[model samples]
Target: MSYDAKVFNVMVASPGDVLAERALFREVIHEWNAVNSEVRKVVLMPVGWETHSSPEMGAGPQEIINQQVLHSCDLLVGIFWTRAGTPTTEYASGTIEEIEKHIAAGRLAMLYFSTTPAVLDDVDNEQYQTLRDFKASCRSRGLFESFDSLAEFRNKFSRQLQQKLNAHEMFKLTQTESSSNQPVSDFMRLTVPSLTHEAKVLLKEVSQDPHGRLTYVRYIGGAAMQSNAKSFLDSKERREVAKWENALQLLQEEELIVERGHKGEFFEITAKGYEVADTIIS
Candidate 1:
Protein backbone atom coordinates (compact mmCIF):
# COMPACT_ATOMS: atom_id res chain seq x y z
CA MET A 1 0.00 0.00 0.00
CA SER A 2 1.17 3.56 -0.66
CA TYR A 3 2.01 5.71 2.35
CA ASP A 4 2.62 9.40 2.98
CA ALA A 5 6.24 10.58 3.31
CA LYS A 6 5.21 12.66 6.26
CA VAL A 7 5.54 9.72 8.65
CA PHE A 8 6.72 10.78 12.10
CA ASN A 9 10.35 10.07 13.09
CA VAL A 10 10.64 8.34 16.47
CA MET A 11 13.87 8.04 18.50
CA VAL A 12 14.37 5.28 21.05
CA ALA A 13 16.57 6.11 24.07
CA SER A 14 16.85 3.37 26.66
CA PRO A 15 20.22 3.11 28.33
CA GLY A 16 21.24 -0.33 29.65
CA ASP A 17 18.91 0.00 32.65
CA VAL A 18 16.30 -2.14 30.91
CA LEU A 19 17.85 -4.63 28.52
CA ALA A 20 14.63 -6.63 28.05
CA GLU A 21 12.63 -3.53 27.18
CA ARG A 22 14.64 -3.00 23.99
CA ALA A 23 12.91 -5.85 22.20
CA LEU A 24 9.49 -4.28 22.85
CA PHE A 25 10.60 -1.01 21.30
CA ARG A 26 12.11 -2.76 18.30
CA GLU A 27 8.92 -4.70 17.73
CA VAL A 28 6.81 -1.53 17.78
CA ILE A 29 9.05 0.14 15.22
CA HIS A 30 9.00 -2.92 13.00
CA GLU A 31 5.22 -3.16 13.09
CA TRP A 32 4.80 0.56 12.44
CA ASN A 33 7.17 0.49 9.45
CA ALA A 34 5.61 -2.65 7.98
CA VAL A 35 2.15 -1.15 8.06
CA ASN A 36 3.22 2.33 6.94
CA SER A 37 5.14 1.79 3.71
CA GLU A 38 5.63 5.54 3.22
CA VAL A 39 7.42 5.94 6.55
CA ARG A 40 11.18 5.97 6.01
CA LYS A 41 12.99 3.66 8.49
CA VAL A 42 12.79 3.70 12.29
CA VAL A 43 16.24 4.28 13.74
CA LEU A 44 17.27 2.77 17.10
CA MET A 45 20.27 4.31 18.80
CA PRO A 46 22.62 2.16 20.88
CA VAL A 47 22.25 2.73 24.62
CA GLY A 48 25.63 1.69 25.90
CA TRP A 49 29.18 1.14 24.72
CA GLU A 50 29.75 -2.35 23.33
CA THR A 51 33.27 -2.32 24.78
CA HIS A 52 35.01 0.16 27.02
CA SER A 53 37.98 1.67 25.20
CA SER A 54 38.90 4.34 27.77
CA PRO A 55 37.30 6.04 30.75
CA GLU A 56 39.20 9.14 29.65
CA MET A 57 36.67 9.61 26.80
CA GLY A 58 34.28 10.83 29.51
CA ALA A 59 31.14 9.79 27.64
CA GLY A 60 32.23 11.86 24.61
CA PRO A 61 31.62 9.06 22.11
CA GLN A 62 28.16 8.40 23.48
CA GLU A 63 27.46 12.12 23.55
CA ILE A 64 28.31 12.44 19.85
CA ILE A 65 26.10 9.48 19.00
CA ASN A 66 23.24 10.90 21.03
CA GLN A 67 23.53 14.27 19.28
CA GLN A 68 23.36 12.62 15.87
CA VAL A 69 20.29 10.61 16.84
CA LEU A 70 18.44 13.56 18.41
CA HIS A 71 19.21 15.80 15.42
CA SER A 72 17.26 13.54 13.05
CA CYS A 73 14.45 12.49 15.36
CA ASP A 74 10.97 13.94 16.05
CA LEU A 75 10.06 11.96 19.20
CA LEU A 76 11.72 10.11 22.09
CA VAL A 77 10.91 6.74 23.73
CA GLY A 78 12.44 6.10 27.17
CA ILE A 79 12.35 2.73 28.99
CA PHE A 80 12.80 2.49 32.73
CA TRP A 81 13.45 -0.62 34.86
CA THR A 82 13.77 -0.56 38.64
CA ARG A 83 16.77 -2.06 40.43
CA ALA A 84 17.99 -1.91 44.08
CA GLY A 85 21.26 -0.24 43.15
CA THR A 86 22.13 1.52 39.92
CA PRO A 87 24.14 -0.73 37.64
CA THR A 88 27.61 0.83 37.40
CA THR A 89 27.86 -0.04 33.71
CA GLU A 90 24.38 1.12 32.64
CA TYR A 91 23.73 4.79 33.39
CA ALA A 92 25.57 6.62 30.62
CA SER A 93 25.61 10.40 31.02
CA GLY A 94 25.36 10.81 27.27
CA THR A 95 22.05 8.96 27.15
CA ILE A 96 20.55 11.28 29.77
CA GLU A 97 21.83 14.30 27.86
CA GLU A 98 20.02 13.14 24.71
CA ILE A 99 16.73 12.95 26.62
CA GLU A 100 17.32 16.43 28.06
CA LYS A 101 18.04 17.81 24.62
CA HIS A 102 14.98 16.21 23.11
CA ILE A 103 12.81 17.76 25.82
CA ALA A 104 14.42 21.16 25.32
CA ALA A 105 13.77 21.09 21.58
CA GLY A 106 10.00 20.68 22.19
CA ARG A 107 9.93 17.43 20.21
CA LEU A 108 9.85 15.05 23.13
CA ALA A 109 6.98 12.56 23.00
CA MET A 110 8.34 10.29 25.69
CA LEU A 111 6.85 7.00 26.92
CA TYR A 112 8.22 5.25 29.97
CA PHE A 113 8.03 1.50 30.75
CA SER A 114 8.66 0.73 34.40
CA THR A 115 9.43 -2.65 36.02
CA THR A 116 9.09 -3.66 39.69
CA PRO A 117 11.27 -1.65 42.05
CA ALA A 118 11.67 -4.78 44.25
CA VAL A 119 13.65 -6.58 41.56
CA LEU A 120 16.11 -3.67 41.62
CA ASP A 121 17.18 -4.25 45.23
CA ASP A 122 19.75 -6.88 44.16
CA VAL A 123 21.54 -4.24 42.13
CA ASP A 124 23.64 -1.26 43.37
CA ASN A 125 21.90 0.63 46.18
CA GLU A 126 22.96 4.04 44.95
CA GLN A 127 22.10 3.05 41.40
CA TYR A 128 18.59 2.15 42.57
CA GLN A 129 18.14 5.67 43.88
CA THR A 130 19.31 7.00 40.56
CA LEU A 131 16.70 4.90 38.82
CA ARG A 132 14.03 6.28 41.17
CA ASP A 133 15.19 9.78 40.35
CA PHE A 134 14.90 9.01 36.65
CA LYS A 135 11.40 7.71 37.08
CA ALA A 136 10.44 10.79 39.05
CA SER A 137 11.80 13.02 36.33
CA CYS A 138 9.80 11.16 33.73
CA ARG A 139 6.70 11.62 35.86
CA SER A 140 7.34 15.36 36.14
CA ARG A 141 7.56 15.65 32.36
CA GLY A 142 4.43 13.51 31.89
CA LEU A 143 6.48 10.93 30.01
CA PHE A 144 5.91 7.94 32.25
CA GLU A 145 4.35 4.69 30.95
CA SER A 146 4.16 1.92 33.51
CA PHE A 147 4.08 -1.83 32.72
CA ASP A 148 3.97 -4.84 35.01
CA SER A 149 5.61 -7.13 32.45
CA LEU A 150 7.42 -7.04 29.12
CA ALA A 151 4.30 -8.25 27.35
CA GLU A 152 2.29 -5.45 28.91
CA PHE A 153 4.88 -2.91 27.82
CA ARG A 154 4.73 -4.22 24.27
CA ASN A 155 0.95 -4.00 24.14
CA LYS A 156 0.71 -0.47 25.59
CA PHE A 157 3.57 0.90 23.50
CA SER A 158 2.02 -0.29 20.27
CA ARG A 159 -1.40 1.12 21.18
CA GLN A 160 0.02 4.52 22.16
CA LEU A 161 2.13 4.76 19.01
CA GLN A 162 -0.82 3.95 16.78
CA GLN A 163 -2.87 6.62 18.52
CA LYS A 164 -0.20 9.25 17.94
CA LEU A 165 0.17 8.38 14.25
CA ASN A 166 -3.57 8.39 13.68
CA ALA A 167 -4.00 11.76 15.36
CA HIS A 168 -1.26 13.25 13.19
CA GLU A 169 -2.74 11.87 9.98
CA MET A 170 -6.17 13.21 10.87
CA PHE A 171 -4.74 16.67 11.57
CA LYS A 172 -2.93 16.74 8.25
CA LEU A 173 -6.12 15.80 6.42
CA THR A 174 -8.06 18.53 8.20
CA GLN A 175 -5.48 21.19 7.35
CA THR A 176 -5.37 20.06 3.73
CA GLU A 177 -9.15 20.34 3.38
CA SER A 178 -9.39 23.68 5.18
CA SER A 179 -6.60 25.28 3.19
CA SER A 180 -8.17 24.08 -0.04
CA ASN A 181 -11.75 25.26 0.62
CA GLN A 182 -11.21 28.35 2.76
CA PRO A 183 -12.59 31.51 1.10
CA VAL A 184 -10.56 34.71 1.05
CA SER A 185 -13.47 36.62 2.53
CA ASP A 186 -13.23 34.53 5.69
CA PHE A 187 -9.66 35.67 6.23
CA MET A 188 -10.41 39.30 5.36
CA ARG A 189 -12.88 39.34 8.21
CA LEU A 190 -10.06 39.06 10.76
CA THR A 191 -9.70 42.42 12.46
CA VAL A 192 -6.22 43.81 12.88
CA PRO A 193 -6.79 46.29 15.74
CA SER A 194 -5.84 49.31 13.64
CA LEU A 195 -6.97 48.33 10.12
CA THR A 196 -10.44 49.01 8.68
CA HIS A 197 -12.31 46.37 6.64
CA GLU A 198 -11.49 48.25 3.45
CA ALA A 199 -7.85 48.53 4.43
CA LYS A 200 -7.80 44.84 5.36
CA VAL A 201 -9.24 43.90 2.02
CA LEU A 202 -6.65 46.09 0.29
CA LEU A 203 -3.83 44.53 2.29
CA LYS A 204 -5.12 41.05 1.49
CA GLU A 205 -5.11 41.83 -2.24
CA VAL A 206 -1.60 43.30 -2.13
CA SER A 207 -0.38 40.28 -0.15
CA GLN A 208 -1.57 37.94 -2.91
CA ASP A 209 0.47 39.60 -5.68
CA PRO A 210 2.50 36.98 -7.52
CA HIS A 211 5.32 39.52 -7.84
CA GLY A 212 5.79 39.61 -4.01
CA ARG A 213 5.28 43.37 -3.68
CA LEU A 214 1.97 45.14 -4.27
CA THR A 215 2.08 47.31 -7.39
CA TYR A 216 -1.03 49.22 -6.31
CA VAL A 217 0.10 52.09 -8.54
CA ARG A 218 0.09 49.79 -11.55
CA TYR A 219 -2.98 47.72 -10.55
CA ILE A 220 -5.02 50.44 -8.80
CA GLY A 221 -4.02 53.55 -10.77
CA GLY A 222 -1.56 54.86 -8.11
CA ALA A 223 -4.20 54.81 -5.33
CA ALA A 224 -4.52 51.82 -2.98
CA MET A 225 -8.36 51.64 -3.10
CA GLN A 226 -9.25 53.74 -6.12
CA SER A 227 -9.18 51.09 -8.86
CA ASN A 228 -10.05 47.62 -7.51
CA ALA A 229 -12.15 48.97 -4.63
CA LYS A 230 -14.23 51.05 -7.02
CA SER A 231 -14.68 48.20 -9.43
CA PHE A 232 -15.25 45.43 -6.82
CA LEU A 233 -16.62 47.05 -3.68
CA ASP A 234 -19.96 45.30 -4.05
CA SER A 235 -20.41 42.54 -1.44
CA LYS A 236 -20.03 39.84 -4.10
CA GLU A 237 -16.85 41.38 -5.48
CA ARG A 238 -15.42 41.86 -2.01
CA ARG A 239 -16.12 38.23 -1.14
CA GLU A 240 -14.36 36.97 -4.27
CA VAL A 241 -11.25 39.07 -3.60
CA ALA A 242 -11.29 37.92 0.03
CA LYS A 243 -11.39 34.28 -0.99
CA TRP A 244 -8.45 34.70 -3.39
CA GLU A 245 -6.37 36.55 -0.81
CA ASN A 246 -7.06 33.92 1.86
CA ALA A 247 -5.85 31.20 -0.46
CA LEU A 248 -2.73 33.20 -1.25
CA GLN A 249 -1.86 33.73 2.42
CA LEU A 250 -2.29 30.05 3.19
CA LEU A 251 0.00 29.15 0.31
CA GLN A 252 2.61 31.69 1.35
CA GLU A 253 2.62 30.61 5.01
CA GLU A 254 3.10 27.02 3.92
CA GLU A 255 6.22 28.09 2.00
CA LEU A 256 4.51 27.42 -1.31
CA ILE A 257 5.39 31.03 -2.13
CA VAL A 258 8.68 32.79 -1.44
CA GLU A 259 8.68 36.50 -0.80
CA ARG A 260 12.02 37.91 -1.97
CA GLY A 261 12.13 41.71 -1.84
CA HIS A 262 12.51 43.84 1.29
CA LYS A 263 9.66 43.21 3.74
CA GLY A 264 8.64 40.20 1.62
CA GLU A 265 6.83 42.60 -0.69
CA PHE A 266 7.79 40.66 -3.84
CA PHE A 267 6.63 37.03 -4.13
CA GLU A 268 6.34 33.96 -6.32
CA ILE A 269 4.82 30.62 -5.44
CA THR A 270 7.06 27.61 -5.76
CA ALA A 271 6.26 24.73 -8.09
CA LYS A 272 4.93 22.81 -5.09
CA GLY A 273 2.39 25.57 -4.50
CA TYR A 274 0.98 25.14 -8.00
CA GLU A 275 0.69 21.40 -7.54
CA VAL A 276 -1.07 21.80 -4.19
CA ALA A 277 -3.44 24.37 -5.69
CA ASP A 278 -4.26 22.03 -8.51
CA THR A 279 -4.88 19.17 -6.11
CA ILE A 280 -7.22 21.36 -4.08
CA ILE A 281 -9.16 22.96 -6.93
CA SER A 282 -9.32 20.04 -9.33
Candidate 2:
Protein backbone atom coordinates (compact mmCIF):
# COMPACT_ATOMS: atom_id res chain seq x y z
CA MET A 1 0.00 0.00 0.00
CA SER A 2 3.02 2.30 0.52
CA TYR A 3 5.28 3.63 -2.21
CA ASP A 4 7.94 6.22 -2.95
CA ALA A 5 7.40 9.21 -5.24
CA LYS A 6 9.27 12.32 -6.31
CA VAL A 7 7.62 15.44 -4.97
CA PHE A 8 7.51 18.53 -7.22
CA ASN A 9 6.86 21.71 -5.27
CA VAL A 10 4.76 24.35 -7.06
CA MET A 11 4.52 28.02 -6.11
CA VAL A 12 1.24 29.83 -6.82
CA ALA A 13 2.10 33.46 -7.60
CA SER A 14 -0.57 36.13 -8.09
CA PRO A 15 -1.99 39.38 -6.77
CA GLY A 16 -4.77 39.70 -4.16
CA ASP A 17 -7.49 40.31 -6.75
CA VAL A 18 -7.42 36.74 -8.13
CA LEU A 19 -8.28 35.02 -4.86
CA ALA A 20 -10.65 32.58 -6.56
CA GLU A 21 -8.04 31.58 -9.15
CA ARG A 22 -5.42 31.18 -6.43
CA ALA A 23 -7.59 28.65 -4.63
CA LEU A 24 -8.33 26.90 -7.90
CA PHE A 25 -4.59 26.35 -8.40
CA ARG A 26 -4.39 24.53 -5.09
CA GLU A 27 -7.39 22.37 -5.98
CA VAL A 28 -5.97 21.47 -9.38
CA ILE A 29 -2.59 20.59 -7.91
CA HIS A 30 -4.14 18.41 -5.19
CA GLU A 31 -6.46 16.77 -7.68
CA TRP A 32 -3.56 16.03 -9.99
CA ASN A 33 -1.60 14.47 -7.16
CA ALA A 34 -4.59 12.45 -6.02
CA VAL A 35 -5.20 11.06 -9.51
CA ASN A 36 -1.69 10.84 -10.96
CA SER A 37 0.88 10.69 -8.15
CA GLU A 38 0.63 6.96 -7.74
CA VAL A 39 0.56 6.06 -11.43
CA ARG A 40 3.30 8.51 -12.40
CA LYS A 41 5.26 8.12 -9.18
CA VAL A 42 5.33 11.89 -8.78
CA VAL A 43 3.66 14.10 -6.19
CA LEU A 44 2.93 17.79 -6.71
CA MET A 45 3.11 19.78 -3.49
CA PRO A 46 1.41 23.20 -3.63
CA VAL A 47 3.57 25.81 -1.90
CA GLY A 48 2.62 29.44 -1.29
CA TRP A 49 3.45 32.17 1.20
CA GLU A 50 0.26 31.42 3.07
CA THR A 51 0.80 27.71 3.61
CA HIS A 52 4.54 27.18 3.19
CA SER A 53 6.24 30.05 5.02
CA SER A 54 6.34 30.95 8.72
CA PRO A 55 7.18 34.28 10.31
CA GLU A 56 10.83 35.28 10.55
CA MET A 57 12.89 38.41 11.17
CA GLY A 58 16.22 39.88 9.97
CA ALA A 59 15.09 40.35 6.36
CA GLY A 60 12.52 42.25 4.33
CA PRO A 61 9.09 40.53 4.36
CA GLN A 62 9.42 39.54 0.70
CA GLU A 63 12.99 38.43 1.24
CA ILE A 64 11.85 36.22 4.10
CA ILE A 65 9.21 34.74 1.84
CA ASN A 66 11.75 34.22 -0.92
CA GLN A 67 13.97 32.25 1.39
CA GLN A 68 11.14 30.30 2.96
CA VAL A 69 8.98 29.48 -0.05
CA LEU A 70 10.00 30.80 -3.47
CA HIS A 71 13.52 29.42 -3.54
CA SER A 72 12.31 25.86 -3.07
CA CYS A 73 9.63 25.81 -5.76
CA ASP A 74 10.23 23.60 -8.78
CA LEU A 75 7.34 24.95 -10.87
CA LEU A 76 5.83 28.44 -10.78
CA VAL A 77 2.18 29.06 -11.72
CA GLY A 78 1.48 32.80 -12.04
CA ILE A 79 -2.07 34.09 -12.51
CA PHE A 80 -3.08 37.71 -12.91
CA TRP A 81 -6.47 39.44 -13.08
CA THR A 82 -6.83 43.24 -12.56
CA ARG A 83 -4.03 44.48 -10.29
CA ALA A 84 -0.37 43.67 -9.99
CA GLY A 85 0.82 42.56 -6.59
CA THR A 86 2.14 44.84 -3.82
CA PRO A 87 5.56 46.14 -4.88
CA THR A 88 8.75 45.24 -3.09
CA THR A 89 11.94 47.32 -2.95
CA GLU A 90 13.63 45.53 -5.89
CA TYR A 91 10.66 44.64 -8.09
CA ALA A 92 7.22 45.78 -9.21
CA SER A 93 5.50 43.29 -6.90
CA GLY A 94 6.18 40.32 -4.68
CA THR A 95 4.45 37.98 -7.11
CA ILE A 96 6.55 39.21 -10.01
CA GLU A 97 9.65 38.94 -7.84
CA GLU A 98 8.85 35.31 -7.10
CA ILE A 99 8.19 34.54 -10.76
CA GLU A 100 11.42 36.24 -11.88
CA LYS A 101 13.53 34.42 -9.32
CA HIS A 102 11.96 31.09 -10.21
CA ILE A 103 12.62 31.61 -13.93
CA ALA A 104 16.12 32.87 -13.22
CA ALA A 105 16.81 29.57 -11.48
CA GLY A 106 15.93 27.72 -14.74
CA ARG A 107 12.67 26.26 -13.48
CA LEU A 108 9.51 25.63 -15.53
CA ALA A 109 6.91 28.39 -15.41
CA MET A 110 3.23 28.60 -16.46
CA LEU A 111 1.70 32.07 -16.46
CA TYR A 112 -1.92 32.96 -17.17
CA PHE A 113 -3.93 36.20 -17.44
CA SER A 114 -7.66 36.26 -16.81
CA THR A 115 -9.98 38.09 -19.23
CA THR A 116 -13.14 37.72 -17.16
CA PRO A 117 -14.88 41.06 -16.67
CA ALA A 118 -13.92 43.12 -13.65
CA VAL A 119 -15.94 45.76 -11.78
CA LEU A 120 -15.28 49.25 -13.22
CA ASP A 121 -14.79 50.99 -9.86
CA ASP A 122 -12.64 48.25 -8.29
CA VAL A 123 -9.91 48.30 -10.96
CA ASP A 124 -6.71 49.94 -9.69
CA ASN A 125 -5.59 52.30 -12.45
CA GLU A 126 -1.84 52.38 -11.74
CA GLN A 127 -1.52 48.71 -10.88
CA TYR A 128 -3.67 47.68 -13.83
CA GLN A 129 -1.26 49.48 -16.17
CA THR A 130 1.63 47.76 -14.41
CA LEU A 131 -0.03 44.39 -14.91
CA ARG A 132 -0.62 45.11 -18.59
CA ASP A 133 3.01 46.14 -19.06
CA PHE A 134 4.17 42.96 -17.40
CA LYS A 135 1.88 40.85 -19.54
CA ALA A 136 3.17 42.57 -22.68
CA SER A 137 6.79 41.98 -21.71
CA CYS A 138 6.03 38.27 -21.35
CA ARG A 139 5.07 37.94 -25.05
CA SER A 140 8.72 37.97 -26.16
CA ARG A 141 9.93 35.36 -23.72
CA GLY A 142 7.40 32.57 -24.51
CA LEU A 143 3.71 31.77 -24.87
CA PHE A 144 1.25 32.28 -22.01
CA GLU A 145 -2.38 31.17 -21.78
CA SER A 146 -5.41 33.43 -21.33
CA PHE A 147 -8.84 32.53 -19.99
CA ASP A 148 -12.19 34.30 -19.90
CA SER A 149 -13.71 32.27 -17.07
CA LEU A 150 -12.83 30.14 -14.05
CA ALA A 151 -14.02 27.01 -15.88
CA GLU A 152 -11.81 27.83 -18.83
CA PHE A 153 -8.86 28.41 -16.53
CA ARG A 154 -9.41 25.08 -14.83
CA ASN A 155 -9.62 23.26 -18.15
CA LYS A 156 -6.51 24.90 -19.58
CA PHE A 157 -4.42 24.42 -16.45
CA SER A 158 -5.44 20.80 -15.94
CA ARG A 159 -4.82 19.93 -19.60
CA GLN A 160 -1.49 21.76 -19.84
CA LEU A 161 -0.28 20.24 -16.60
CA GLN A 162 -0.80 16.84 -18.16
CA GLN A 163 1.18 17.96 -21.20
CA LYS A 164 3.96 19.14 -18.85
CA LEU A 165 4.20 15.90 -16.92
CA ASN A 166 3.35 13.47 -19.70
CA ALA A 167 6.62 14.28 -21.44
CA HIS A 168 8.53 15.95 -18.63
CA GLU A 169 11.70 17.45 -19.96
CA MET A 170 10.51 20.74 -18.42
CA PHE A 171 10.95 19.65 -14.83
CA LYS A 172 13.72 17.07 -14.79
CA LEU A 173 12.95 14.35 -12.30
CA THR A 174 14.40 15.37 -8.95
CA GLN A 175 14.99 11.84 -7.81
CA THR A 176 17.17 9.27 -9.54
CA GLU A 177 15.37 7.03 -12.00
CA SER A 178 13.70 4.14 -10.27
CA SER A 179 14.48 0.56 -11.27
CA SER A 180 10.89 0.32 -12.40
CA ASN A 181 11.99 1.16 -15.98
CA GLN A 182 9.08 3.46 -16.75
CA PRO A 183 9.80 3.79 -20.48
CA VAL A 184 11.83 5.47 -23.19
CA SER A 185 8.74 7.47 -24.13
CA ASP A 186 6.60 8.05 -21.08
CA PHE A 187 3.09 9.03 -22.18
CA MET A 188 4.50 10.58 -25.32
CA ARG A 189 1.15 10.06 -27.02
CA LEU A 190 -0.27 13.02 -25.10
CA THR A 191 2.57 15.37 -26.02
CA VAL A 192 1.47 18.69 -27.51
CA PRO A 193 3.21 18.17 -30.81
CA SER A 194 1.20 15.05 -31.53
CA LEU A 195 -2.21 16.76 -31.44
CA THR A 196 -2.90 18.82 -34.53
CA HIS A 197 -5.60 21.47 -34.61
CA GLU A 198 -7.72 19.17 -36.77
CA ALA A 199 -7.52 16.50 -34.09
CA LYS A 200 -8.40 19.00 -31.38
CA VAL A 201 -11.39 20.26 -33.36
CA LEU A 202 -12.73 16.74 -33.73
CA LEU A 203 -12.09 15.78 -30.09
CA LYS A 204 -13.81 18.91 -28.80
CA GLU A 205 -16.89 18.45 -30.98
CA VAL A 206 -17.23 14.74 -30.39
CA SER A 207 -16.77 15.01 -26.61
CA GLN A 208 -19.86 17.23 -26.44
CA ASP A 209 -22.19 15.02 -28.45
CA PRO A 210 -24.67 12.49 -27.11
CA HIS A 211 -22.95 9.21 -26.13
CA GLY A 212 -19.71 10.86 -27.27
CA ARG A 213 -19.95 8.98 -30.56
CA LEU A 214 -18.39 9.84 -33.93
CA THR A 215 -20.04 8.10 -36.86
CA TYR A 216 -18.39 7.37 -40.20
CA VAL A 217 -20.43 7.09 -43.37
CA ARG A 218 -19.31 6.93 -46.99
CA TYR A 219 -21.58 8.74 -49.41
CA ILE A 220 -21.50 8.93 -53.23
CA GLY A 221 -19.48 12.17 -53.35
CA GLY A 222 -17.45 11.83 -50.10
CA ALA A 223 -17.07 10.06 -46.77
CA ALA A 224 -17.92 11.79 -43.51
CA MET A 225 -17.52 11.53 -39.76
CA GLN A 226 -20.61 12.94 -38.10
CA SER A 227 -22.23 13.48 -34.74
CA ASN A 228 -25.34 15.57 -34.02
CA ALA A 229 -25.38 16.62 -37.69
CA LYS A 230 -21.96 18.26 -37.35
CA SER A 231 -19.19 16.91 -39.59
CA PHE A 232 -15.56 16.14 -38.73
CA LEU A 233 -14.64 15.09 -42.24
CA ASP A 234 -15.03 18.56 -43.67
CA SER A 235 -12.71 18.18 -46.64
CA LYS A 236 -13.57 16.59 -49.99
CA GLU A 237 -10.12 16.83 -51.58
CA ARG A 238 -8.03 13.66 -51.15
CA ARG A 239 -5.17 15.10 -49.07
CA GLU A 240 -7.36 17.32 -46.94
CA VAL A 241 -9.73 14.42 -46.35
CA ALA A 242 -6.78 12.23 -45.32
CA LYS A 243 -5.73 14.84 -42.79
CA TRP A 244 -9.13 14.91 -41.11
CA GLU A 245 -9.49 11.15 -41.16
CA ASN A 246 -6.00 10.83 -39.67
CA ALA A 247 -7.15 12.94 -36.76
CA LEU A 248 -9.71 10.29 -36.01
CA GLN A 249 -7.02 7.57 -36.16
CA LEU A 250 -4.71 9.54 -33.85
CA LEU A 251 -7.49 9.96 -31.30
CA GLN A 252 -8.18 6.26 -31.43
CA GLU A 253 -4.50 5.38 -31.12
CA GLU A 254 -4.24 7.58 -28.02
CA GLU A 255 -7.23 5.66 -26.67
CA LEU A 256 -9.07 8.97 -26.40
CA ILE A 257 -11.63 7.39 -28.69
CA VAL A 258 -12.71 3.78 -29.28
CA GLU A 259 -14.38 2.11 -32.23
CA ARG A 260 -17.89 1.02 -31.24
CA GLY A 261 -18.99 -0.80 -34.38
CA HIS A 262 -17.46 -3.87 -36.08
CA LYS A 263 -17.16 -2.10 -39.45
CA GLY A 264 -15.31 0.81 -37.70
CA GLU A 265 -18.22 3.07 -38.55
CA PHE A 266 -18.87 4.31 -34.99
CA PHE A 267 -16.28 5.74 -32.56
CA GLU A 268 -17.08 6.50 -28.94
CA ILE A 269 -15.16 8.81 -26.62
CA THR A 270 -14.00 7.13 -23.47
CA ALA A 271 -13.83 8.70 -20.02
CA LYS A 272 -10.15 9.30 -20.60
CA GLY A 273 -11.14 10.85 -23.89
CA TYR A 274 -13.44 13.28 -22.10
CA GLU A 275 -10.66 14.28 -19.69
CA VAL A 276 -8.25 14.90 -22.54
CA ALA A 277 -10.98 16.75 -24.42
CA ASP A 278 -11.59 19.01 -21.39
CA THR A 279 -7.91 19.90 -21.43
CA ILE A 280 -7.78 20.63 -25.15
CA ILE A 281 -11.17 22.24 -25.82
CA SER A 282 -11.49 25.09 -23.33
lDDT of 1 by residue, 1-282 (tens): 542344445666665767777776766566555433322222223222332123444465655555445666666776766542222233434556667677777775665757555444456666556667766677666746788766557556755665564456533574465445554454334311233344344344433333223322224422221222233223335565565455445545554445544654444433333223333311
What is the alpha-carbon lDDT of model 1 when measured against the actual structure?
A: 0.49
Candidate 2: tens digits of C-alpha lDDT, residues 30-49: 87776557655779998889
Shift in Å, residue 35, candidate 1: 2.1
What would you estimate as the lDDT of candidate 2?
0.80
Q: How much is the lDDT of residue 115 in candidate 2?
A: 94
**Which stretches of candidate 1 lie above 4 Å from their native place?**
1-4, 38-59, 83-92, 117-121, 168-282
Candidate 2, backbone clash total: 0
Best by lDDT: 2
Q: After superposition, how far is residue 253 of candidate 1 from its true place, in Å?
A: 46
